[model samples]
Target: MLTHAERKRGIAWGLMSLFGITLFVGAPIIALLSWDMETAQTRLFTAYTWRILRFTLWQAALSTALSVAFAIPVALALARRPRFPGRLWIIRLMALPMGLPVLIGALGLIGIWGRQGIVNSLLLKLGLDQPVSIYGLSGILLAHVFFNLPLAARLLLAALERLPAEYWLLSASLGMKPLSVFRFIEWPAAWRVIPGVAGLIFMLCATSFTLVLVLGGGPAATTLEVAIYQSLRFDFDPPRAIALAFLQIAVTALILIVIASFPAPDDTGSTAGRITRRFDGRTFSALFWDALVILLATTFLILPLASIVTAGFKASLWGLVTSTAFLHAARTSFAIALAAGLLTILTSLAIVAAREAIADMKRPGRAARGFSVLLSGTSYLVLLVPPVVLGTGWFLMLRPLGDVTRFAPALVAVINTLMALPFVMRVLTPAIETHRKRAGRLSASLGISGLSRLWRIDLPVLAKPLLTAFSFAMALSLGDLGAVALFGSNELTTLPWLVYSRLSSYRTNDADGLALILGVICLGLAILGTAGQREASRG
Candidate 1:
């Protein structure tokens, strides 16, 4: 039933996909295995390492619980409340934190609650003798909530949106009170997503290096990632670093196993059940609660961004623009991001094509089947191997590559593409499935295959998702600081690295300017990539 050309295309695609997936999953293990730890003391089973393991797990669990708990009611309110004039924009703006660099987001948090920050400024204005110290657990937890609340809201909102219109209509017909409607309709739908979203956020928080490193203030707030970096880069303790890296991996694997055991909530049904938009105008109590939630969420989201913009302008704009380091860093960041974006898109396409081919086979033989299984299993490796650990491996391996600094661009590109593959795969998987469902028969009947089928049928159907995936990958690549940190030299600095360096040196004003610029650049690229594909598909 298949031709030679189709088989060749599939093979090529599969090979490329294998490479992309392998780079992510294999790189980390390779790094871990290569780690040269010179010590019985440095072994992974050390008591000190075990103590950190316990603390990391504890924080991640608590943070995940708090993030999900806060997100539930907020997500419900947004879904059920009347769509005011700016609701769509409000929702879109809420997603900004996801796009923002972690360091920048942390900085924004600092600007609000730091010792000399706006909240403290206000407290002083109110005649308080001292500002609240926001440097330990309070800072870490608050920052985690700020970054994750919108994301959790988005995940839960999506679930709420999927409720069938029939559910809403029935609720209305029954004259269900708001609480009753929530109990009967929204909660059931949203509760399912809680575990997955919470787990994901927890994982992110746990793996977080820059956030904890910066906001953590000292030893009291140190996370496993920070500890690893401190051991490797600062303390120069390879045995401790390796042991810590393993500890992080073990903890992550355990958590992931727990998360995987819980089924992911359904994401499809309806964008919103056909409920009539009702404003709670008649009930003062309902109105007060609604306004309070909105106000609190909005303030938490907006004030930090506002502070960044405000600080950026207040800083010597002329000096910031004129700084050679700033310009060089920006150029380096853009160049690497572009290279990474292109590589990621190509690799992701190959992966998609390969997956489609195997899945298309009438009956894959054991050899073909084995390859498919290997490819499918690759994504999990990414979750297992943290970026810092991989970066450490590459740093060790590339010692002989000559001018590791010059190779920084290529190394960064590789790491960025790797970091972005999971997100790209997520975006493309559904789109690919939809395209196959819609065009599988038509293409097969028409005898179309390979590039011809892709160009004529799949491309049109996949344009939007492809663009979304590309944009997401690009944005992620631009914001990454992990691999770049290990690879960066005098000439190979990136905007994120520059931001980090500035923050490390306490050049807060310069960091703010660079952050604003970086955020805008990433946002613009994402918008352009996504919008361009959407328009093309429409045309």
Candidate 2:
């Protein structure tokens, strides 16, 4: 029933997907295999390795616990008070950290919590004997909480919003107490989603590189990711780096498997008519507590962003704008982002198309379902292979062929594409699947196929999701520090690299200015992506 052209297109896309996965995921893994097993084994068993691994696990657990604990109250407050002033803006602001560069967020945290930060400044003015420091374990925890608290709050709030109206009505009719209502209703709903959220936050913190690298003041604060960087770039020990990379992958894979056991949080469902009429939290004390929670959450999320804007403007905006190095880095970042974004979108489309083609077959068998699963799962494989590990593996693979620095930019772009794959799939799959479901039979009846069918059907419907996915991919690549960190040199620097370089050399002003620029660009891309989604919804 399929036309020759359609069959050809499907085959081509399937092949393309295979090629991309092989090139990006397989190559580095193959490269890692080139190392001697005995050397890698020896490196893996050292006390230093075990210590770093333990620290990584400890910090991630603490961060996940703190983030989730703080988020519950804040999410409850947000859910209870849906009509509060600036509520929508606060929700949007919660997402800012998603698009904000890690280095920029770190800078903002330092500005507010560092030894000379406002809190410490106030303490000093009060004649306090000791100043606080935004370095080491505390700093790592603070940064992770700042980045993930909003995410957890948003997810929990969405979950709360999706609760049925009947539950609130039942509680109100029964005159249930606040404690009783939460025990009977909210706790059950939230418990289902917490594992997934916690797992994601833990993995993010565990694999944290940029924030830890900047704030980790000494060896005591180093994470597995930073250690891997040091092993390859500083120590020039390929075996040690390979061993660490393998350890990181194993730990991440185990976490993913655990997370898979939980019911995945559904973000795409309609919550429009689901707002429950709450009978709890009506007392003055309850109201005050909720208001206090919302205010504190808002302050925690917004103050660092405000600090970045103020510090950047006051310090070196003009000098940074006019500097040659800054311009080159910006250009490099832009090019890489553009290239990576396009590549991610194209590759995602191919894999998605192949899956659709499989589904469109007259009789999809076990093989078809398995292939579809493989296609979907390939995107997630990138999660297990951390960017640092991938970069290290590729470095080892390429070192013998030629100068690896020459290929750094391309490799960074490829790695960024891989990192963006999961996100791109999330955005595209739903749209593409909906389109195919709605129109596939009709297209088949009319014998529409290939470019004709695509142009007439798919493109018009998919334009918005495609654009949104591209913008998100670009934003992610633009702000990426991990992929570029291993390959960054004078000849191949990005804006993030420039910001980090300035920070390393103690050029705080320049770093602040560059951070601001990078943050603004990323924010713009995020806005662009969301704008398309908003328009699509309205249409």
Candidate 3:
């Protein structure tokens, strides 16, 4: 057990950390709530508000349905054809969409699907007069599917891969038909993942800010997030912004409630990667079907990414790379990203320390478990409140103090820190707990506690995990477009905002060049983050 003094101190720090995060997040919410209730009700009842709400729900539902539905077949194809050419490369490619900045992804899609894009170029050559439009709800769905489908497919593929060797062997021995094998063996694993995957995709699509903002065309295509941005940045409508923010929170909470009501699938035993080789789907028709699904999914995912690369190379970026404005934005993005990552590490450390202390106290399981849930939930609390909402709240809160743009960098850093908190905690907490478990008792017996122990013991030992957390957090913050959208100004801008400006000004080539640079940096950081984790595990 930790010493009484250390335990008490930890508990205090933990409570304080939780309270601080709560306050940071709650301040904006309080700003939203403290408005004139009568005015709030009036704003709440508007036709425009209801229209945006309906569109928001409709697009998110459609995106989630399309992504998850298409993922099943793609995943099944990959699982059944493990030895196919470029299989590993195809799996690796799926992660690209997740790492690429939202603005960059949108730009990439526009290059392929826009009115004057490659698709239209080909169609014109074929004597077609009509051009495809990458605007409105059609464009929004295209972007969402481009980003989410691969994610769902990867998740489902993992589930399929986890089935034990024995199950497949039994199926083969029984001479089960292909449909029977899928129904009894594969379907269960896929089904287990579907609900949780669907919920996550739903939440992601619902809160999507940059994608919809870029492709939303106008009011008719806007999601709640985009609507909030328009209210604060475009219309200067604080009351409407606040109303939309609460609407967003309510929608998110309701989704969570519905998701919680569905019991999660229980964990199945692991195969440890020694899967029983399957001897199925060898018929001509089966081969054709698998090939078709895999081919289509790969093409759908690759076209945009390839467009980003090829089109980016064709653009002349010497002027962009040498510009003062570009340099300033890059510097600001990196500085704010670094600050946010550092802050995330500190906050995660305090929270993890509290949890370890509570575990040492050996309280009743239910009580301890409840406290753990509360602490964990504190990290994720930011997710429910989209970054745009956070920006709007901060904007309202700071309006009385003169120019909000003057405080843009600080506010963006703070919001980015919160946005990165949940993810950083996921990475840092387990590593901290593991290290503490291995070293806590030994250090305690040696009378090592407090700052000395942290610097000498924890810091030295947990360096890899800490680096991983910092780099990953930085990667996320660096590419964030949502929080920056409402806060971006001439004095304070980020790479994402800069690219968005280019896109807005009809400077597609400059945007593509900037996107390539930004995407490479973000992807490199993501790779480093995961590489650090692997190295940490090895150590």
Give the count of colliding residue pairs in each prediction: 2, 0, 0
Better of 2 and 3 by lDDT: 2
- Model 2: residue 241 alpha-carbon error in angstroms: 1.0
lDDT of 2 by residue, 15-123 (tens): 7787677778888888787778689989899999999999999999999999999999998888778777899999989988877889999999999998768888888
TM-score of each: 0.90, 0.97, 0.94
lDDT of 3 at 403: 88
lDDT of 2: 0.88
Superposed by TM-score, candidate 1 places the C-alpha of residue 310 at a distance from the truth, in angstroms, of 1.3
lDDT of 3 by residue, 1-539 (tens): 47888877777878888888888889988988887656767898899999999999999999999999999999899988979779989988998898788888998899889887889889989999746789999999999999999888888888887887777788888998889988988898898879988888888988889999999999889999999888878888778888888999999988877777655533333457675587878889999999999999999989999888988888877788889988999999999999999988888887887887788875547866687678888888877787888788888889899989888898888888888888788778877888888988898889998788889998887887788889888988999898889878898889999999988999888999999888888988888877866775799
Which pairs clash inside model 2? none
Model 3 earns a TM-score of 0.94
Give candidate 3 misplaced runs (Cα > 4 Å): 263-270, 364-371, 445-448, 455-457, 533-539
Query: Residue 161: error of model 1 in Å?
Result: 3.1
At residue 229, candidate 1 shows an lDDT of 80
Task: For residues 134-176, write the lDDT of model 1, one tens digit per residue.
Answer: 6777788888888888988888988887766777667767788
| Ranking of all candidate structures by their lDDT, best first | 2, 3, 1
